[model samples]
Target: MTKEENEKRLAYLKSIVARLPEKPGSYQFYDDEHTIIYVGKAKSLKSRVSSYFHTEVDRFKTKVLVSKIHDISYTVVNTEEDALLLENSLIKKYNPRYNVLLKDGKTYPSICITNEPFPRIFKTRTINKKWGTYYGPYSHAASMYAVLDLINKLYKPRTCRQPMTKEGVKAGKYQTCLEYHIKNCLGPCVARQSFEDYQKNIAQAREILKGNTRQILRDMRAEMEQLAEELRFEEAEEVKRKYLLIDSFVSKSEVVSHTIDNVDVFSITNDEKVAYVNYIHVSNGSINQSFTFEYKKRLNETEQELLQLGIIEMRERFNSHSKEIVVPFEPDMELENVVFTVPQRGDKKTLLDLSLMNGKQYKFDRLKQAEKLNPEQKQVRLMKELQEKLGLPKLPYQIECFDNSNISGTDAVAACVVFKSMKPSKKDYKKYNIKTVVGPDDYASMKEVVHRRYSRLLEEEQPLPDLIIADGGKGQMGVIREVIQDELNLDIPIAGLAKNDRHRTNELLYGFPPMSVQLKTDSELFHVLTQIQDEVHRFAITFHREKRSKRALESELDSIKGIGPKTRDGLLNALKSVKKISEANLDTLTDLIGAAKAQIVYDYFHPENTTGES
Candidate 1:
């Protein structure tokens, strides 16, 4: 919380790290709040734990984590593998912020075939290996559901969660379900279909799941012919329909080649901060599986290094151990007896192209996700860009821009529109009705608003803005500097925006004696300045128009005598207009108020007439 406190905590953490053993282990770094901020594996506990304190430990996240470290803890392990295991366990247990955990709050869906008597085939995210046979980690729910739909259509499998046993069915303990009634399932529990018969369909379903559909279809065709030869027309018809359904579904899948079996394909793309990897698992000539994931590059990691990391991470996550992997380019990583192919042309190249395309799409999707989750970071980036472009000493995280608006001299008003983190804070916007400044004096009006703004902020102990923007050239900037620096002795940086003859934003000006600060018209800094200028101008003009309208309305009503504020408001409210009060009949006017007062109001508008009502 304070510099001394932070220094004391850092010293404590360094002391703890100094005592670590030379053994392989896992280490934890705790923040000032005594919460674990990082979990790491170490081949040597002392060396790894002390690395954070060394002068050259320069990864952005590592540096931040080290700065917050209040304590260090370690668990010694027997081997490097054991260290890795323990580190993973601690990271999962604590979910440390600095760990490279790939979580987007979404897990690929899978189809599980329960290892029970009536083996229910269903789509699920959770899998207990002892309970079922899992077919996939499908990248999208729609794809998994599509396969599930095909399986349901082909096999008529039971989908209910009801437990079943041979004895239970024999004793009539099991009842027919809605699945059977809708024909989505054959009533296997009721013995409507024999166990062997159901297993036959399931065996074929396994082949389909493995992308061996052509072989399964051939077997189905042969069985159908045999059934037809035996004159079992209905049975043959059912097999024929299933064969056709599986054929149609298989046709939709992209097929590279019949020889492209039991292979994994990888593509990697990298920006400065992160790497995106796309994976495809090929089985029996078809793309059986696909997924895209990203990794944050810690230390300017190269594409080859990132690809190696991603390959290991993804294969372990997806549980793929294919002997051969096809990649866009060969990585330096060596896996025992695993071949990596970089295809120059043909279907393999096409497949590589597809995977690379997926990588690009994954990168784009992550940018969209980052935009949604960390809106403040977007504004921070803009502010930093603006500061660098203008060579400001600090980022203008809080900016207050002023605009003075008036029509000649009447309704002179100034508005202070605040931009916090490059976003408009309408609640912080202040409107100043001109005082101590007469007529349309932009410089004086600017000076008065700047003085009042900072003076009140100082009085209330509210934080002042990092920068001030005046909506004019050196003239307005000079006056604001007089108030903020010369008068209040505040050192806040002040800038100005000058307009061309058409009163549109032209260029930015800043300094003690303001001059043009050149910035590209298409740049983010220019866009931000334009937005601030437009917003403050709009806010000032809107306030000025409102003040002018209210004054005009009041002055118009003031011309009529005996029409006090109460009667004026009543006329506006009841008649719904001040204009309609003159058109009312004498009785109407009398009904609104007493006839005596109404006569004065009615007679004021029609002074030439000798009214009988009066």
Candidate 2:
């Protein structure tokens, strides 16, 4: 915004803030279009709103937000808790641009138990309150199916859609379908099963859904024993089957310990633009529900604020009433009856770690999905990572790596490979022969190459690479810095790839003294670094081999007095190898080349024959 316009907006916001009551409330900021762009809850509306206009408001995003605001509105509340609830509801309703965006779970399926006389249980994507109690909007369909399967095996609830009232059942309005014939149902539509018995089974299933399996297991075991004592072997065997099913299902759940019951565990992690929160609801020592979700950040929200919002959302969604909550850190808000524990050790700590792992995994999966959609995002992310790791002021969009290669200093050569956006740019790759430096003096060769490369770039006013990497350890980095910084007085960031005993890239070295920056060997960042190292090495080696081969060929042919370029080309074209040219007879050589050049070549190879003729 223009300076005058910005000052005008600040003055308008300050006047509104002066009039705001000092009570706990939620405030909304409107843009020039009169649309709400931000909503926040505060203990004192006047104090919070006034702080935004203070001169000390230095955060760039916050300044931008304040500059956009054309108006302010607020709602007075009785307490901070009420303001929090009001803020949450308003955020959900309006979804302001500057509020944390919660990804909705309406698309996920929930296990709903119908509210009919014979409540049918099934998976559904919709939630209707008149349709009975909904257990979950399950993120993983497989886990939901597992629970449904267990319920079907144990309770044998009716799966039909028929609405059977008491009068309808008595008048035989509904007929038994194939479910009854297949013994999947007890023909409840025809009243073959007592109402009381069906209701009891549904009650048991509800308990199981609530993750109260231990009590159900005990009751089933007791009933099984009673049936056996009464000489009802078939009924007892059926009860045994159900008891075993519940037991197996419970065993599969992650159980922290029986001592720790009815607790909620939460973990939070974030990237530049998004925050991920993982929730695990433990009931009766078993993990009843596990979910990981992300919040798209609009402002620079802290981990504490996101975690508190996540705790409220998860608790409300799961209807958790656990008195104890385990978190990685203490949140900013407080609940009347709830206690937040930041466990340092033991099972609770392990549970916290498990939640953190899920959060990180969810973040990773989301990143992968985004990168797949826009492949360039992956490159940009890697470049940012490289920049942050090397402490460079800017993203290393263009990186150049240098390497020198020689075999006993015969054909000394250096190669500089260019990488633009973390990929090799073969067009920009350069090869240089050692001129001022002789022998296999790697340091001197590198100095000459570095000096020549950048001096020309500067002279031509071309863009220099954001980062320059030496394909060696600290010593090589020092050499490049001297040429680039000390001599040329250019301020290019330089780094080096340090190798281990097995001749593998181990870590990156950076800075003046060249401190090691360790990178995971399996990470994509490390792969990119190694790729740059390998490309420079490969280019230098290939160039060295070509130059050496050309020198060897020149020494053999060009050394002869009469073997001009044309005559040598003619001889090489006919005889592919130098050995073949040496072994050829005069007649063959004369036929391939002219008689004059052929005689010189033959005499050179057959010195003994020339001596005898003389």
lDDT of each: 0.81, 0.89
Can you write out model 2's per-residue Cα lDDT over 1-614, one digit (the tens) per residue? Answer: 78998788778788889899989999999989999999998889999888888889888988888878899999998877678778888888899988899996788898998889889999999888887899988777888999999998877888887678888988889899998899999978889987888999999999988888988989999999999999999999999998999999999888888888899999998887889999998888888888887899888988988987888788888888999999998887777688999999999999999999988988888889999999899999999999989889999999999999998876899999999999999999999999998687999999999999999999999999999999999899999999998999999999989989999888888997999886788999999899899889899999998898877887899999978888887777888768899999999998988798889999998998886633
Clashes of each: 0, 0
* Highest TM-score scorer: 2
Clashing pairs in 1: none
User: What is the model-wide C-alpha lDDT for candidate 2?
Assistant: 0.89
List the candidates' TM-scores in order: 0.62, 0.81
Clashing pairs in 2: none
lDDT of 2 at 70: 96
Q: Per-residue alpha-carbon lDDT of model 1 for 1-614, expressed as tens digits?
A: 78898778778877888789999888887876889887777679998788778888777766776777777788998876567657666765797777665553146677888898878888788868999888777766677787888988988888778888778878889888887898877898899988888888888888787777878888889999999999999999999999989888877887878888888899988776777888988877888788887777544556775676567766766677789999988875456678899999987888899999988887877776886799877787788777976688888889999988998877899998999989999999999998988787888888888888899999999999988888888888888888987899998998888988998788888886777887877766689888999999899999999898777767777778778888877777778655788777677888888798788878876677745764
Give the runs in model 2 whose Cα sits over 4 Å from its true position. 1-38, 44-79, 155-201, 433-439, 458-461, 542-614
In candidate 2, where is summed lDDT lowest over 10 consecutive residues? 605-614
Q: By how many angstroms RMSD does model 2 differ from the true structure?
A: 5.2
